[model samples]
Target: MNITVHRPGELSAVDRAAWTALQSRAHLHGSPGLANPFLSPEFTLAIGHERRGVRIAVAREDGEPAGFLPFQRSATGVGRAIGLGISDCQGLVHRPGFDWNARELLRACGLSLWEFDHLVSGQAPFEAHASATFASPVIDLDQGYDTYLRHLRERSPKFIKGTLAKERRLSRDHGAVRYVHDERDPAVLTTLMGWKSAQYRRTGRSDRFAHPWIVRLLRRLFHTRADSFAGVLSVLYAADVPIAAHFGLRSERIHTCWFPAYDPAFAKYSPGLIMHLGMAEGAAADGIAHIDLGRGQKVYKDSLKTRELMVSEGWVALRHPVAFGHRARRAPVRALRNTVQTRPELFEPADKLLKRMGRIRSRGGE
Candidate 1:
């Protein structure tokens, strides 16, 4: 096997074709949700245009492309999975039965350590380095939306009924509620970013939208359309006024739920949940087979999920001084977060504290 690295934009047409073919084959023979759009070259290329650090590692065997790993490298010889925080799935796009080594792969890329928080399952090479694994919930909709709704009804009958009732009440009180599965209006997207930023602040989380690069990335993706990948912005309106919205990426069969937010004034109506239902119904019609809700745990995820996908959080590193220093710097915070997420007793207090801090910050800004 031979390995070579290139900037995302430097990939040749033949390289692009090979990557797409391998991705399609993976979808055909692998698990149902393996056709993640985030893993596509289209995605990495878009990100590379926005982020200069992005690079791709192309591996060849017998003179044919065997695998691809897209990542971001820092000057300090540290690396990360491309779009680590925002990407729902992370793994090398490789042919099945291929043998690879994680550490060696990093060495080839000139990195002492490669960190990832959302490593997709079935990545045997990275499994040994994973400090902890978490359940990433998903809604399988291959049988269509009705089938998915039925599953929800079985799991939480009252929740479904209550949500529908709230939807009806929301419509009557505001205006006739309508849903746009692929809204083209840029203004609505702006509104979504505003709401999302507020949501992050209210939850005591860093507002990703505050970063200009992230905002630009979303805009670029929103206009991108292709068979293997497209950016979808779904919105719900009441009396022609947008109340809730979601912006996610989709391939032919997989819809990855990314940024979702709703007008806080409509919180009583549970607009966020309403927006998801609309997205699911519309996505199924568009040939989407599954919706990846990402790696975090939440009540809504438990109520809506048909299955769970496992993802890992950790770093793969060589025994080098830089790698050791990086680990030492991050270990305390990483350990604390993992402990809280894994323990209900500790998690609740940490969550409350975050909310308290969020409130304080929001009030100060106001």
Candidate 2:
């Protein structure tokens, strides 16, 4: 096998086609996770246009492209999954049975360390390096929306019933409720970002939209049109005013839920939950078989998810000073966070503390 590195934009037409074909084959071979839009070449290309240091490593067997690894390299030679914090699914898009040494791949890309949080399953080369693994919730819609709804009703009848009731009440008190599965208006996207940013600040998390590149990236993706990858903006409105919205990426068979937020003024109506249900219905109708909710535990996810997918988190590093130093500096903090996240007793207290800190921070800013 031979490996070559290139900028995401540098791939030739033939190379791009080969890369996409490999992804399709992987998806068809029972690795449906490869069908995620975040793992598509279009996403990597978009990130390359918005951010620096984006690169793709193409591996060839007998002069034919067999695998692709899209990543970003920092000046310190540390590599990260393309779009890192924002990308929900991360891994090499390789043909079935194609394998490479993790350290060799990193070296070829001139990277001393490679880090990923949501590394997809079936990545055997990177599995041993993962320090932890987490369950990513998913909604299976292979049998279509009605079947999914029946399952949901059986699992959490009250939750679905109450949410639908609130939806009806929301319409009655406001106006007719409407859902747009592919909202194209740019202004609506701006509104959604504002709500998401405020939500981040309220929860003591770093606001992703504050970064210019991420904002530009989302805006660019909003207009992206492709057979395998596209940005989907779904909205829930009452009285023709937007109450809840989500911006996520979708492939032909999978929709990866990303940013979701709602107007706090309508919080009493549970507009977010209503919006999610609308998204599920629309996705299923569009022929999408699964909705990946990403690797985080939330009440809404627990209520809606049909099953879970395992994703690993850790760094693959070469035995070098930079690698050792980076691990030493990051390991303890990661350990503490993992401990808190894995244990509910610690997680709840930590969450409360963060909210308190958020309130203080918000006040100080005001």
Residues 86-199 of candidate 1: C-alpha lDDT, one tens digit per residue:
888887888878879998999999999999888878888987899888999988889999999998898899999999999999988998999999999988899999999999
Which tens-of-lDDT digit does each residue in 85-105 have in candidate 2? 899999999888887999999
Cα lDDT, all candidates: 0.90, 0.92
**Which consecutive 10 residues in model 1 have the weakest lDDT in total?**
26-35
Task: For model 1, name the residue pairs that clash.
Answer: none
Quote the RMSD, in angstroms, for model 2.
1.1
- Please estimate how well model 2 matches the true structure, expressed as its whole-model Cα lDDT: 0.92
TM-score of 1: 0.97
- Every model's TM-score: 0.97, 0.98
RMSD of 1: 1.2
